[model samples]
Target: MKKRSIIGLTMGGLMLIAALCTKAVTPTLRLSDTRPKIILGTAIPTKFGDWQEDASQVAAVVNPTTVAELNKIYAETLSRTYVNRQGNRIMLSIAYGTDQRDNLSVHFPEGCYGGQGFAVGQTSQVVLPTVAGGIATSRTVATLNSRVEPITYWVVVGDKAVPNSWEVKKVKLAYALQGMIPDATLMRVSSIGEDIEQGYQLQQSFIDQLLQSMPPDLRGHFSGTSH
Candidate 1:
């Protein structure tokens, strides 16, 4: 009986120590935990070429008037996160009716290792493509990425509403930028480039097309104009 009791006590003690050690091994923050899914947001690993290309192409087709307006109206962005096996991170930022102040932005920062983030920093200027002197212009300030934890995103929307149904325009891009971050030289290029403003110009064009497609009656709602 004495020998059996000693064995039982030893087993119990070992089990308790093992449990405590297991708890200590667990990460404090578990940065590896998958980020929450957002309605209009998605994350893609860097290896996938189509991901960045598709996004840039979309931005190219849709044009916003000015860099400011482009930033405000439409931008699918990812920040502070590296690419996983899938593709570059992607998130859509759009206002429902015309509420700019209470906008929502999604961030996927979990998988970033290094050299992963917004292609253009806050200071960088992105000039959108343009056909000519066209639609109205407006500006709003917003952030797309943050260096801290939990990831951060800034989606800017103004009190602008779309009048008609959603209009999608597919414009052929002579050149387009893939991934959120561009190379060093591209970053320095002006929004009003010698011929084209890489990121800004293309996105602006689509914004204009989207606005024009809106039903003539609904146009006023997004422009913050009353007919």
Candidate 2:
């Protein structure tokens, strides 16, 4: 029999916990503030454990762009990509803020769930404390036995800027969604090959969404590709 693998994701080093035990902090959104806590479109090295640098590095690039463009990219990518170790192969980001509720519900469903468990206590690298004063975050990681693979996630609550280029941004967003798959299911070549295809789709969608959502001033900056 093929080795059954536990899909796992380590989000910046944070762990998933039971929703009931978890606190829901109301996110504060301000239309006026568009500036990012960190410089937009800059490379952010991996701060978490051994898990690959694909997602975090990706976000560091695109989070600063407009939301409209980002969403466009997101929807497109998911259609093209497949969930796997490489990254999320989807393209949907609109549900991010709201999906926190959805994922929490999945994680702590009314009945018994196999991936219900979370990583043992939090690790320092897992948590990315708030910056810019307005941002707050809630994250979780889930493992899928045969269905989806395991993944780590970061649900940021705020009108804060995302880091990285468009490609990286898509990776981060996809990871947030597909991170639930088990690790072992992803090791297979078939799974990984599909993931790469999906990764590009996710990246394209992220780019489209960020471009669509960008404010006039920011959009100009992105078009020029200088800084």
Candidate 3:
């Protein structure tokens, strides 16, 4: 009976020590209260350069399952179609998550498009030069039947633009270690056309002009730079 009692005491003491160590290592952190000050709809201008919002058509380009998933993950989402004077139309989608953790990260267009029955093809990394600095972006061409859509998209994790999943995880872990729950946004611009090169060029031009027209303070939020 004494031996059994000593074993029980030793196990309890070890469990207590483990619990104390966990408490010491785990960060005592919470998301900042003043985050996500810039609203997506108001920050992005309605009319920039020759591009204007197309009010006639309402195409979100997201499937029902993805939409449902997004509703749970993101705090806000904006989907709009913009047309230029030369009849070039681009679909713009932005999703913002207040808490960008592993389970609640922003969804990329490549996977989302694949989920929506679109065949994703030929993905490449591209650098888009904004007024602040050069932001790394991903370009992918998605095809569905006769429609070919060229997409340019990027994800902003914390204050930096991450190009791939590996970078995203690194950024998130860095923030986590600093006791911060970083916010993230996924910005995507796509156009349906035959020439993928021209489509990407136009999208870049659109992004440049749009960034130029935005407020100086708010530009960093989208461009992932303080400058």
Query: Which of the numbered candidates is closest to the native, going by highest TM-score?
Result: 3
Query: How many pairs collide in each candidate, listed in order?
Result: 27, 59, 0
lDDT of each: 0.27, 0.26, 0.81
Question: Which 10-residue window in model 2 sums to the lowest lDDT?
Answer: 181-190
The local lDDT score (0 to 100) that residue 113 gets in candidate 3 is: 83
Instruction: Name the candidate that leads on lDDT.
Output: 3
TM-score of 1: 0.25
Q: Flag regions of model 3 displaced more than 4 Å.
A: 1-32, 63-65
For each candidate in turn, the TM-score is 0.25, 0.22, 0.85
Task: Encode model 3's per-residue lDDT on 86-169: one tens digit a residue.
Answer: 898888888888787678888888888888889999778978887768999998899999999999988888788877777888
lDDT of 3: 0.81
Q: After the best TM-score superposition of candidate 1, give how far the Cα of residue 151 lies from its true spot, in angstroms.
A: 19
Give the least accurate 10-residue stretch of model 3, judged by summed lDDT.
25-34
Estimate candidate 3's RMSD in Å: 3.9
**Model 2, residue 147: displacement in angstroms?**
4.6
